[model samples]
Target chain A: MKLTVLYFAWVRERIGLPRETIETDAATVADLVEELRGREPRYELAFADLSALRVAVDQELADFDAPVRDVTEIAFFPPMTGG
Target chain B: MAVRVQQEDFDFGAEADAFAEGRADAGAVVTFTGLVRDRPDGGLREMEIEHYPAMTERAIAAIEAEAVSRWNLVDSLILHRYGRLRPGARIMMVATAAPHRADAFAAAEFLMDYLKSRAPFWKKEVTDAGAEWVAAQAEDEAALGRW
Candidate 1:
């Protein structure tokens, strides 16, 4: 499966890219994270602390254990500071 | 319901007035404006707000829909700004209208409570010394439980 992954704020800063396209057979969001972490040190650093991060699969807030089989988009970012 | 996310500054008074204009069904309207506060130490330079564009709109609209349904609001508006903002600039505004004051006020509060953490916006504080992303407060998340 092909997925477009996005990063925002410090997550983008740490990952050194705002977005990327990856091909993976990962079934869950956590599996995808693991695949990315195995790619390079930058991804490992950005994903080092899952507690500090949030994920959105297909533009909806999703859990780490959420399935991503048909998901086209995934975004990772720090917890929002809005309003 | 209306949700606007932009980099341009908006006229709060004008927007609020327009939202309430000639609405016979609504007797009470409440508006809340959020502004970037200047640091007490006077060391802050600007606020850099970054957001996931598509998700920001979707998330805000979803929350607005929830507020309208929960409170039976007559109307609602959410306008948020992104990108670089100077201290004292209007960062965002939320307005809610209902037949009664209680519904109007509560709906506005609910919109605010959710917007603080649910929306995809992230704020970065820039100062003379350096710049840092503002971490989301735990209290903000806990505030959602009140709903």
Candidate 2:
């Protein structure tokens, strides 16, 4: 499936990119993350610590185990602190 | 109920007037305007806010729905702005109208707490030294637990 991924805050800083479109065979959010992590050293470093990062599927807050099949987008970022 | 997420500034007086305009049943109106403070913890010079477009709106809508379910509110309005904002600029607003002050006040506070803790928006502060990402405050999480 084709998916647009977004990174924000420190995650964006570490990754050096804000958004990208990727085609992957992953079925879950965690799976997709691992796919990205394998593509480059930067991805590995950016996703080194999953606990500090948060994921959202199609713009709704989601867990790492959430299914990603047919998802149009998946965003990864640090925990929010905005009010 | 009205929810607005925009880049432009909003007029509180005008918004409040429109909210209470033809609603005679609304005996009490409580509004809270959150401005960009100099420092949330006395450790900042400038702040940058970033948010997920779809998630931000979904989260706010869910919070508003919760307020409506919990309070006997006649109407409610929520306005939040995105993009770079400087200090003293309005960040958000929550206005609730009900038949009594108690419900209006409680609902307004509840909505603010929810937005602060649950909304998926990240804030980074830039000081003279460097920039640092802000983390969710324990106080905010604790406030949400009270509900």
Candidate 3:
């Protein structure tokens, strides 16, 4: 599946890229993250601690275990604190 | 119930007037406007807000719905602005009207609390020294847990 991944805040800084398009065979969000972590050192550093990061699949808040099939976009960022 | 996520600033008076117009049952109206502070603890200069297009609106709508369910509110309006915002600029507003002040105040506060902790918007501040990303406060998450 083809997915557009977005990184925000400190996650974007650690990853060095704000967004990207990737083609992966990963079944879930966690699996896709692992694939990215293996591709480069930056990905590993950015995703070092999943607890500090939040994920959204197709613009809805989601967990790492969520399925990624048919999802066109996935965003990763620190937890939100806006009013 | 009205929820508006816009890039333009809004007038509280006009919005409140519109919300309570022709509604005699709305005896009390509570409005809360959040503005950008000139200084943060970290010496921040400016705030840059970014939001998910579809998700932000949905989240706000859910928050408004929850507030409506919890209170006997006559009408509610939530307006939030996005993109770059300067110090003293209006960031958001939440207005709740009901037959009494207690319900209006409670509902307005509830909406603000939910928006603060639950909304899916990211903020980055540019200071004279450097740029830093804001983190979600544990207290905010705890506040949501109460409801």
Candidate 4:
């Protein structure tokens, strides 16, 4: 499946991009993170601390173990500092 | 219910009046606005707010629905601005209306608390020194426990 991954705030800073597109067969967010981590050093560093990061699949917040097999988009970012 | 995410500034007084006008059943209306404040680490130049365009409006709408589900609210509005904002600029606001003051007030607080941690927006403080992303507060997450 093709996926559009988004990064916000510091995650975007570390990853050096706001959004990206890739094809993956990873079944869950954690699996995808590990896959990306293996592809480059920046990915490895940005995703090194899972506890420091938050994930949203298809725009709704979800856990690392959450399934992403059928999702089109996923976002990774630090905890929100909104209003 | 109204959920808006934009880069433009808003008029608080006008927004409050617009929410309450001609609504006889809503006896109480409450609005909370958050401003950019130069504080503990004060070298303040401006703050840049970043948010996920695909998710911000939906996320706030879900929060609005949650507030309505938990309280007896007549109507609700959430307005949040992104991009660069100087000190004292309005960053966001939430307004709630209900038949009683308690419900209105509680619903407004609840919306604020949830939006603080749950919304997709992220703030970066740009000071005279440098620019840095603002971290989320532990207390803000803890505040959710009350509801």
**Order of candidate numbers by lDDT, starting with the best:** 1, 4, 3, 2
DockQ of each: 0.93, 0.70, 0.74, 0.95
Candidate 3 regions exceeding 4 Å error are B40-43
Best by lDDT: 1
Model 3 pairs whose backbones collide: none
- Backbone steric clashes in candidate 2, count: 0
Tell me how far the alpha carbon of residue B59 in candidate 4 is from the true structure, in angstroms, after superposition: 0.7
For each candidate, the alpha-carbon lDDT, in order, equals 0.95, 0.86, 0.87, 0.93
lDDT of residue B19 for candidate 2: 86
What is candidate 2's CAPRI-style docking category based on DockQ?
A: medium
Docking class of 3: medium
List residue ranges in candidate 1 displaced over 4 A: none
Provide all candidates' interface root-mean-square deviations. 0.5, 1.3, 1.3, 0.5
Task: Please report how far candidate 3 places residue B40 from its true position, in Å.
Answer: 5.7
Docking model 1 quality class? high
* Model 1 chain B poorest 10 in a row by lDDT: B65-74
Which residue pairs collide, candidate 1? none
lDDT of 4 by residue, A5-59 (tens): 9999999999999999989999999999999999989999999999999999999
Residue by residue across B25-124, what tens digits does model 2's lDDT show?
9899999998877775666676678877777888889899999999999999988887777778888889999999999999999999888867877887
RMSD in Å for all candidates: 0.7, 2.0, 2.0, 0.9
TM-score of chain A of each: 0.98, 0.96, 0.96, 0.97
